[model samples]
Target: MKKYAFAASAATIALAVSGQAFAQESDAFSTALADGAVTELAPVTVTTPLRRPTTVLQSTSTVTVITEDDIEKSAAPDLPSLLKRYPGVNITTNGGQGATSSIVLRGASASQTLVLIDGMRVASATSGTAYISNIPLSSIARVEIVEGAHSAEWGADAIGGVVNIITKDGSTCENGASVCTTVETGVTYPWGGYGTVSTRGVSNSGVNFNIGLSLLGTEGYDFTTADNSVHEDGRDGFLQGAFNFALSKDFLWGRLYTSGLYVRSNPHFDSAPYADWMTGETVYGANEADQTNAAFKVGAEVDHSDTWSSVFELYSAFDYQKNFRDGHPEADTHYDTNRYGLSASTTKEIQAGAALNTFTLGAEAYRETVDSSVEYTETARDVAAVYGQYGLELDALTFNAGLRYDYDEQFGDAVTYNVGLGYELVEGLTARASFSTGFNAPTFNDLYWAYDGSYVGNPDLEAETSKNWEVGLNWAPTDTAAIDLVYYENRIDDMIAYVSDPVTYIGTMENIDKAKVSGVRATYSQMLFDDRLGLDFGFEYRLPKDETDDVYIANQNRLKLTAEASYAATEKLNLNAGIEYVGSRWTNADNIEYTNYAQYQLGAYTLVNLSAIYAIDETANVKFAVENLFDEEYQTAYGYKAPGTTVTLAYRRTF
Candidate 1:
């Protein structure tokens, strides 16, 4: 049954992606697919918040992709809510949209998974990692999620894989020129109303542009036993604009991209467990936090000759953040990062049938400087790296290997490597295994950033290191059926951990040895009913041990299961549903024990959504969607409640 469901889901997605290409053919993911190898389906394209590299597969581990269609149908107000559809991934928050959202992958801490924005490292230099809840997804092109120990490919903070946010660039017009816009406004029964407006335009010069602004504010929802409702004061909005130019066709073929984002949100704290006895309200009720991020990049591909192609890029970014408590300034921070990288890769046809090989080599470097007024700190880190990747295929056997050497001011020198081999036993069956070594260098905040009388930084912290290995089998009996099973183990050496002394009330970061994780993942997709309906299923169990070898590390979960289905009810309408179950988890540091266990198992729930897009005319479109059809009461975080049921109606036109 699971396998059948998985196949159906894949079929539905294939249909959707294939059909959507007719409307917007210039999407990056679609463009990448035009050149890369196509597997059972295709790897999901994700640009984690870090401005490193766009990814398709976990490459080194497990990965999952959630499409833009899935986002619209789910009507999840924010990133945290939408990510709940994944099993091994957990989303916890205090309350409301754009609140403090924590993402725990494979029982790792919220700070373990590094979030990226179009390849740039956007994680807070002070907090180590940024909360995904506060980032809006209005203009998201797609999300690429890689799961596993990836401190190797990326630098610090990617103990788990990475979540890359790849935004949409401008699309080309078929005729003279065109522009489109959509505006939506809706009201929640008890909270309040929200609105969003987006516009995109393309000029005759082959320049594409897009801009969007959105606002969401709501009253709090009822807690398990509290009289004071979950409340959201002030409003949260994201403003983004991007432009793309063709440059030239012969001499310099390139594109220029730029984007700016700002978010100001009212802080919402966790409700006291015993709401009946607590007298004081959650502090920061009147607090506000603001973030401003801007990035600009110019990339060009010049043909030195016919066989060798080169890509050179120059980029710069600036970020500033401020937090206010009780309407007074509490902290302010500013960061500026500059980077320049160049890659020269070439492909040649070695043979026609027996074997083929492709190689890629590149050198890159970046410098980051951080200055803080509230914490009274100034720090800078520079890294220079050289890497190479090679892929070869011989009949039924395939191999991929990569190596990178990086020199950092704080960590000295480090080397990371990954190698994998896959063999095909039959037309539809293949087995593969891989082993990789990765490391995480300490962040600026881990060595600096101190406030109050209770905090300390560790300047001598050793780099966190890991050795990971995995074996798996993939089968596709037919084009309509597929399944994958993978088992993995990871050994982490000198893991970075923070310890707090109660008597002295002091907290400091330290390098602790002895950490390990082992897990198994199963995923399946299938098509049914003449490929009109589809289903997808995924299940994973991970045992991440701390220094004491306990699965309960802070607030991460050990078991996860996720399922999704979609049906093309008609040519004009589609119905989809998704549900995820997160098992019990605990935090020893916080002294919080989840009781009843089974009853407290997040109350297994389901969410059903329906969407219909109709073409009123050649250039006009009408879209309607409903989310949380059952109105189940649940919480992504410990005590914070999610929205009940919601609906959205929108209309768009192109000229």
Candidate 2:
């Protein structure tokens, strides 16, 4: 890492004395820095993963950070909306901001992605997933996304990746003050407009306070291509608040933190005609859904010593949804979940020759309680695990190994492990490889979601476990140019899915025996013209094999490509643009054949986004952005159309 500083400093001096011209240059350097330049340092450290600072590149797993500067430049409305800019992430949204947002990584479902707020799990055990839309983007300091399985080190709900949201802390204020405040307001157009206001301040007593409220209304587009049909379109608002306090700094110090969210939305899903199947009658009906979500999290972290730490966290979340279809009574669905856990770990670093060897050991236990009325399933279970990690540096090579054993009342026992090896092949080149295993317990809904006389519930179901292998190479041709290539393969045993009896229309969760997913990614970035301009390009490809003798899934894309560029044309001016292309794929769930289908292909679409900002003095600036420049009509969800032609104009002032 010291070598990186030396290289960056030398390049900075050259760029400072030179001048260049380019439309835009893009890379991690541009998006990760506070002012689009690594030379101008910020008070916050650059490598914090979740809540603590550490070397990012040397981590056992891949970590990608989206700084506050990146979010402000891109002008994304929420966290889920911003993740699409990263490599190897697939996002699906029902509509604009605060909507149903889902993420798929390495061919795994949205539920496989574990979301964390300052290292504590935010996923709902009842539905077995996180309602990402409920998470406000206002007070977030940074986001650290660690990609890939981490059951060995992170415990459950980590099969795909971990999205850790690190909120703003008291130290972010000026002069290390005990009190500070910040407020921002913005608007957008669609149905009605939108407005938001949020504030954060700290007390000299090591306490922090934050509150946010937003109101937005939209007169959504038509459900179909009809002249006078306004099926269902409405507006919604959200309120979120959080508080954190730190006690003394002695042996028995204490800390408390809490956050709550509330939202109300009316979304249209499908079209229906009014009629009675058993009786002849003329009726008028509409398709509409009203949904609400309320969630809260509380946690405390205690540091017992220089080498020991312990944390206890608890969370509760609830969701209610009702739908009206074709002149019938509203169908209601309710989901509630409770989660609690405690973790304790110790880290020891000892001098070994000329280097340091680190060892870590920890134990954790958590419980999930889920209840769903329509699902007709009630389940409760607790899970406990113990893990250890060893890291050592020998000559030019670094090695990391971890192991964990977990026992669950509902899923029996499982073992997870990981091993990583890295070697500095040359002065500017490095090679690395890692092997790990992960597991995901079946969700209650997947086991038992029933309707009418049909039901699906397999009491005896095995957890899905995956074995993954990855090898990668990183190269730096010069001080300002870096490139990387990685290949990964994942295989799963006893994957669970819904199986149905054709005659009875009854479905049951069953093990699929085997499934395989493999992929590769290539990324390149460079600072051109002596570091005044930047450019970044990357591509990812994935292929999933069912491996089940009786089933097949279609509509899976084999490739995704992303390109971004940023330019600091002048000391006071900055501009950026990004383009993404997602390949076409199929969408069939079962091997059984059906006639007269359009193959359900989502056409390949290209999206272009632009941003420009000019600094006014030192405390104020004007900004502008245009999203979906071409107004491309695309659908990430099966039948839902994405937003189009959004323009934003705003101003910012820093005190």
lDDT of 2 by residue, 211-297 (tens): 555555455454332211322443322333333322222225545666555555565544434455658664445355555655455
Cα-based lDDT for every prediction: 0.56, 0.60
Task: Give the lowest summed-lDDT range of ten residues in model 1.
Answer: 18-27
CA RMSD of each candidate after superposition: 6.8, 6.0
Per-residue lDDT for 258 in model 2?
A: 62
TM-score of each: 0.79, 0.83
Q: List candidate 1 stretches off by more than 4 Å.
A: 1-61, 172-202, 208-286, 305-307, 326-353, 376-378, 501-505, 547-551, 589-636, 642-646
Residues 1-655 of candidate 1: C-alpha lDDT, one tens digit per residue: 0112212223334222311110000011111111233334334333231123222222324555555555555556568767776656777776555456677665555666777665556665556666565566665656666666554456556666677765555544322257666555555433555566666666567556766676666554443324234433333322222222222223354334454444444443432222333566333322345545544455655555554455566655555555544433322233433333333333332454777665556666777677665352447777777777666667777776777787888778888877877777786576777777767777667777565677777778877777778887766665655667788887777877777887987887888746677888776666667665567677778877775455445555677776666665654455566666666555353334446332233444556545555545545555565557678776655545666676656554554
